[model samples]
Target: MDWDDLRIFLAVARTESLSGAGRRLAMDASTVGRRIARLEAAVGAALFLKTPQGYALTAEGARLVAPSEAAELAATAASEAVRAEAGITGQLRIGAPDGCANYLLPQVARDLCDAHPGLEVQIVALPRVVNLTRREADMAIAVSPPDTGRLMVQRLVDYQLHLAGHRDYLARHPPLRDLADLKGHRMISYIPDMIFDRELDYLSATGMEVAQISSNSVAVQMQAVRAGAGLGIVHDFAIPFAPGLQRILTDRIALRRSFWLIRHADDRASRRLSLLADALAQGIRAEVLRLEGLLGPCPVRGT
Candidate 1:
């Protein structure tokens, strides 16, 4: 039977409705019905029995289900294996959320390009997480370690946020005497929901509830602070990269963030993947140390 027919069969069998399967497959209802009919004719058995409630699989359909799923799994594996064998020659699609891409990716990309001259890198920099199971990206740099099953997870290093402002902004604010003094100032950050929990907690702890100008990009936030718009709690990488921005420390900035390197479970064994992962991990380590130096040294740990 055609693979398309089996694909429709699996979608319909798992979802138990022509419309549901069609939606998942991005096909129209009539098209799904026609394909299912074609599949049933080829198999010489009715796969579904339409009842008032919906469609239910027949005994014969149930028997076919396991093998169909196994076929799909085999196909998926074969595709990945083929791509892996192609080595670093094809595109290495990387998914990165905005913050990591802006403050964290340039060095890594440079290093990867130097190491793997044949490899092409396609960066899918997004403000939100990309779906790996759909092959949206071959690997990703994420703040939260992916819970996606069987993916390889590498904890790169921990990073910190420090309050930062431009020299002129700091001159006017005259150095924060204490955390409570922050109440009267403009504080910049991502939408509170978008910021990691540790940063949000640090903001809340100061009892300063200032409306943040909405920003998804760390680069944008750093620019806002440099323009004297407000004091920003920014990652060390973001601030140092901004040039002339100084840390505003009355006491330690309490927000600690972690970086994670994620790859497709199958990519773990691919030599191209291993090379890229090593390069990224190495770059991240160096950046962490650079950030520490910018912050004038702190008791921080590396990967």
Candidate 2:
């Protein structure tokens, strides 16, 4: 079967419709349908089932997914190998949690673009983990490393978090002398059930089970904390961006977690991905250090 047919097949399987695949491939729906039929004929089996809603992958289609994806990866690697000479220029979409995207990605993008004038970078910030297998992003930066899938994981950098509060909020409330005092302060964080990663449940170890103010987005949480909505477990790198925020019980509550660089295993051979990943890792490490350095000394250990 033609590799182009397999490419179309993967697009349809991902989007679940001829029209959807057409939009992705820049082909008409009828043309996409004909290609899918041609692929089915070459393979001697129907690959999709027509349902009221859309095309659903049949058992045969399901089985073909892995090998077809491998073919797609190979094709992509071949094309990228040639383009590598053009100096890392292409659309590289990176999916990341909103906090990093909001607070960290702009500078990374600036550095990459300034270095490689032709490259276009897209930062897709979402509330949940990025789905690289589905081609949602060429790569992703994640707080928690994934356990499943043909993916490569690398530790990007470790960052610190601490219980923090707006100085106005701290002044309005009773003094926060220690960890035990957190029980009375309004705390902001990810909603308990909506937290997408265990590492992000930053308030859990503090014996606080509920968040009085919460949001799925870290930017929102930080904004709420800055607006004096509540005290929160916040990234030290981020605290400098939100003025008037102070790290509370810093010595007692300092926390460390890491960001990971994740990508499809098949992409290891692609120079574009490799270059982009290297740049991202270095940029993030430098940015994190630069931002955290902007923070003033943390609040005294107690009182």
Candidate 3:
């Protein structure tokens, strides 16, 4: 019945682990457990079913989801109203692909937090789709917009990817005169089956069938290329950081892809969410411009 108890329940349901929920709430695991027990007693019904995998919401808990979310939104609105008279203070979670999350989000997060001292930001670097409907994240950068969700989607920015290799690897191997020559090279790429998003299937466009070396992480793939393993597709924004890596066939081959910013429709009017979204979009646009300066103009129009 207490709003604080409902907040704990929401966190536990979203994270599905006592420790994870506790970390979000800044409480210890035992305390989170005790609170859940107290909440169940108040409701006079079991809320979560414990399983080896994690806590699963019971029927009673599932029924509480909508009301809990409504309460959360109302609390957010109230907080935002007060923030106008004071300053912004709340948590904002963003979900993004590992590549972007690892390379880009940290600096942006720091800047946002610095500007708003009381604000907290968490970045979920996940390869799978982040369910905005389930409150997995307040906002997400996705390859494609959802078709069925009640969401507000906007094109964030377009970035370029190109085939690249380490300077040492290029010197040791035959020169890549054309696309066909790539067939003989030990290409590095994502594990095909592990590519969660269709937009990540860069190899298919290259007409390359084999990946002699592969990894699920872009950071690993970049490391593989840096170690002289082989040529691989890499983001232009990432290339500037890896001094030894050089773009191959810059004019002949360029891939353009875009990231879409998505959030729940209900959160559209939230001042904090709107401000954060604008800041995110600006940061991404600035990065894209920097990448284009280094990689030459993007080959495709309106990516």
TM-score for candidate 3: 0.90
Candidate 2 is scored at a TM of 0.90
- Estimated TM-score for each candidate: 0.68, 0.90, 0.90
Candidate numbers, best TM-score first, in rank order: 3, 2, 1
Clashing pairs for model 3 are: none
Stretches of candidate 1 exceeding 4 Å from the true structure? 1-87, 193-202, 298-303
- lDDT tens per residue, model 1, 150-251: 688999988877777787877776447666567767887777777643423445544567546657667677789889888877777776677777766525
Report every candidate's CA lDDT. Answer: 0.73, 0.89, 0.85
Off by over 4 Å in 2: 17-34, 41-44, 50-54
Q: Output the better candidate (1/2) by lDDT.
A: 2
Report model 1's TM-score to 2 decimal places.
0.68
lDDT of 2: 0.89
Task: State in Å the error of residue 10, model 2.
Answer: 1.0
lDDT of 2 at 255: 87
Question: Candidate 3 deviates by what RMSD?
Answer: 3.2
Per-residue lDDT of model 2, residues 204-299, tens digit only: 866788888888989999999999988888998888789898887887888899999999998887877898899999999999999998886776
